[model samples]
Target: MNIFSLEGKNAVITGGGSGIGLGIAKTFIEAGAKVLIIGRNEEKLREAKLSLGDNCSYKSFDVTNLDAIPDFVTETKSNLGNVDILINCAGTHLKKYAVDTTDSEFLQVLNVHLLSVFALTREFSKVMIKRQKGSIILISSMTAIMGMKQVVAYSTAKTAILGLMRSMVAELAVDNVRINAIAPGWIDTPMLHKATDNDLPRKTKILNRIPSGKFGMPEDIGYAALYLVADASKYVNGVFLPVDGGAAGGF
Candidate 1:
């Protein structure tokens, strides 16, 4: 048997219309799984589906709409049958320091990154527990592991995700439902470029710090995510798998 094969598995990837989420969707589909990509942009989702082909599907839904999640989960299950994997990659970023950040902004960030994610996990893990099989991946970031400027809200949410994963594992592991977090380092995505393009010094500083000496590709995170949900990692549980190129551990 192919230990890495995800054949017959059905996956739901939030924020899968672009960047790392889209990369994960592509990898999952290539590994023989059916993927449903969700995001707030219908056009992007349509384009992603077109590129990913028939094995891929999509839904345009705002994750922050917490009340809509239950219905969304129900509809997804009805359409996709059983969700073998769920990826919480949907999030919003705020580039503001703590002093400048307002209460509304911080709460908004938490609502999307933390609250929505928990709701989805709670709803989906129930079905997985009943079936006694499932893998859930939360997309975390370097900010969660270390300090970063102008991303206090983002860091807090990501850090909380790790806590959420660890807490869920205690309950879900007994049923063979594994939940974990992937902390991706600086990736070569539009988001990264947007943060670095005009700030050459910052970009250089980031690149210099990474032992790999270069920014990582979105697929880098995808492959790590694939392993977490694949049969190869069945024994692994409640871990913070960092896909950063030694940046988190390096000087």
Candidate 2:
């Protein structure tokens, strides 16, 4: 039997209606885990459910709505049982120079990327503590390690996630609940395409920095997520695994 198999595990993936979130959901389902995806778009959630088949489910809820997270978690647990894995993949990015960024813009990024993630994790940790076994994976970014132009707000939020992951690991590991993070480089997602649209020079510059000579596919992160969330990484904690194709290690 594969030790990494997620059979019988229940996972909750945020922002799971599309992009990296969707990729993770698909992979988890393939590994025999029951998935409950959360997103703000009902139509997208329905579409994702259709693609994932019966073993997968979804809920329409915005992660930014921190006040309702506990209730949402409660409802999900009632419907699907205790969640064994939590993937904080819900986040937003604002591409603008620091000077051009607004206070609201920065706050919005923090609200979704940091505040909401913390809230959801806190709620889930309560349950996991009772169970004494769980895995939490936060979706961080390469920008968290290096300075990147036109994404000051996003960079700040992503960097904060690393700190959050480490802090959670320190506190949660004692209870046998593992916490970690994944820092991805430029990935070939809709968000990346939108960010680089009509900016061939910027896109080319990013591509050149990646030693792999191409943007990472969603499946790359998916595989990493599976490893961390499944039994394969049961002992791993407080580590920020970079799925950046060497971008973080390059000049």
Model 1 lDDT tens row, 209-247: 899899989899989999999999999999998899999
- Would you list the C-alpha lDDT of every candidate in the order shown? 0.93, 0.90
Candidate 1 lands at a TM-score of: 0.98
User: What total of clashing residue pairs does each candidate reach?
Assistant: 0, 0
lDDT of 2 by residue, 1-251 (tens): 48889999999999999999998999988899999998889999999999999999888898998889899888888999989999999867688999999999999999988999999999999999999989999989888888879999888989999888888888989999998899988888888998898789989889898898989988889999999887777778888889999998876
**Backbone clash tally (model 1):** 0
The per-residue C-alpha lDDT of model 2 at residue 145 equals: 86
Give the Å shift of residue 187 in candidate 2.
Answer: 1.2
CA shift at 64, candidate 2, in angstroms? 0.8
- Residue 217, candidate 1: how far off, in angstroms? 0.7
TM-score of each: 0.98, 0.98
